[model samples]
Target: MSTATATPEGALPHRDLSHTPWRVLVLGATSGIAEATARIWAREGANIFLVARNADRINAVAADLRVRGAAYVETAVADLDDIDGHTALLGRAITALGGLDVAYLAVGILGEQPRAEQDTTHALHILHTNLTAPVSLLTWLSNYCVNQGFGTLAVLSSVAGERGRKSNYVYGASKAGLTAFLGGLRNRVDREGVHVLTIKPGPVRTSMTTGMKGSEKFADPDKVAREIARAIDKKQDVLYTPFQWRPIMAVIRAIPERIFKKLNL
Candidate 1:
């Protein structure tokens, strides 16, 4: 049985979350980019529900958001990879928030490329967390939003997904799949008044890219978060953070396979 709230059909487009006191749900609330984005919403006095696997980290995040001026902050500790629990978890979140306005999905992993190449288990783990789990959550969320006729689904994909490079093809593939999924989901739900945003960010100064080469050149998370906040208000369909990544990925995609495979990415 579905637990989603129902509303009158043919409602108008959702009001932008830029309005103060938005009811928001942040999955993977402990991630650097996610936490930074939540902080922006917090300053607007948004009501938030945080979900993540780490109890200590999630609790700290909730506390910080409250201090940052969020009107309300609630949290639940749960591993999002457990697809079986998504429905119940989302139900609780919606209840806590009084209703749903925006859901930011910032859950993903960058598995060791060499290890993934040798171990199917490692590769599958990456795919499961980055792809399958998100699909499950989106399926439930999209339906709920469709029934109510309003919501924004902002998801984190990666510029790496634009074209696969030998360096981290496994992670790239997962993001590529997610990007495609978001595209199709937008096509299906846009007419129903649900906005689906695919956020393709280049490497940012986050824990995920902490030890990587050229880490000093990565984009700042705070700046990226600001763009994201604006994009949601504008209801953009796709966002390339740092903006330069849009052209950079275009060039990479335009390269022919014969010449591309020879050059290191």
Candidate 2:
């Protein structure tokens, strides 16, 4: 894609990709939330470049999106944990899409707390996948968007990140790290004509959470995707799926440490 030669003179021009036929890069493209969002984008006729560890699944998703009205659909198979390949993969995505209008990073893994506590390697692996690798990708994309002068960087975070819970503190910590990273990155990149949206959603019905029991409060991935699309259009800083999650997390965060520690989350 052709880009302007010089930086804009003042505040960035307003641009929204939600309903337009724009270019989008969906990292972790085969994941439930990512795939759901892809469908929404497809219905709006966006051109999509998808990257995920599962080649077969991504190929199927790409095909399905074509039928859903996507102007173009392309797929690449790779694990986000392989940080060494991030620069090249992102480069390929930008080239394939002409310009990346939005990049949704939905790559993460949940770890068993008992196993993580007992094995150093297990905890590190979760940290690597959930936090380290994503930071690398976001850093690279940040610079690109800054130079190109427009892009939306939306990363999937979790409400668990708001506070450490005994049930899933290990996974929660990784998410907390992600949440902090996005917060700082957003502040750094906002003025660069980039909108960094930190998407914090409560549990959603997905294969990843299939083993999670008693998910009465869980939501549908499609519904969460719709809210995400809305956030992108509005260039929201932090988005809580279901909207109710915003106040819920706020209450969770406001609890004093002394009182918070005394009660089970």
Candidate 3:
């Protein structure tokens, strides 16, 4: 009953979409990195479905993509936190696209550590948003991809997930869960010809971190977007934005637990 495509190249970078126009769905389309990626896809004349909570924001993004020479652009506004809506939302996305070639999930939140530590409610919301919701959506999408047999799935995890830091362990724990999920999902689906990419971005200068200082190490979303496009074209398994975060996190994870805990992150 699977309608999966037997394409060896997967949805992305298996072939150039410059002329063929692959269909792409961008979840959390309003995020800075997602917005930048959508623009890159637009330049290749890809058809895109933008999903986000804000209708007006998604509309503006759609207009920009249309103007950028996207073959087709549409919007589906919904808060990604609503796990119950994922099935209907993804169903609508694939239906609008006619079929799905690639889906980029770029939804998450940076909850306040202080608040999370003080209140179980705050902690649970962060966990649900970053871990539970994405898991639910990815499970659905993975099944769809398996049955369809052709697609690329990329998710935005965080380098903070590499190892839990005291400052943002709640956020870190969520991403850590997501990262593990992606790894398992990738193993299960790759043989079926689906590309599952786990993207870990370090500090990013965006609306979420606007007021936070110490952004000197933050990667530019535009630059990060371009790199992501290249990685997709190559059908990569894991990508660390700006290419430097990999080693940075590697060293951090390599430290002994006793030593790591003693040092301030």
The TM-score leader among the candidates is: 1
The top-ranked prediction according to lDDT is 1
Candidate 3 lDDT, 1-265, residue by residue in tens:
1232222222333323544688899999999899999999999899899999988888999999999999999898898888767777788788788777889999888989999999999999999988988888788888777766767899999998999989999999999999999999999999987789999988888777777877755778999999898888888999999898999888999999989899877
- Pairs that clash in candidate 1: none
Query: Where does candidate 1 stray beyond 4 Å?
Result: 1-20
C-alpha lDDT of all candidate models, in order: 0.91, 0.86, 0.86
Model 2 CA deviation exceeding 4 Å by range: 1-20
**What TM-score, computed on C-alpha atoms, does each candidate reach?**
0.94, 0.91, 0.92
* TM-score of candidate 3 against the unseen true structure: 0.92
Expressed as tens digits, the lDDT of each residue in 1-265 for candidate 1 is: 3433433234434565455579899999999999999999999999999999999999999999999999999999999988878888898898888788999999999999999999999999999999999988898899889887889999999998888889999999999999999999999999989999999999999999999899999999999999998999899999999999999889899999999999888
Pairing residues by index, what is the TM-score of model 2? 0.91
Candidate 1 displacement at residue 182 in angstroms: 0.3
- Candidate 3's C-alpha runs over 4 A off are 1-19
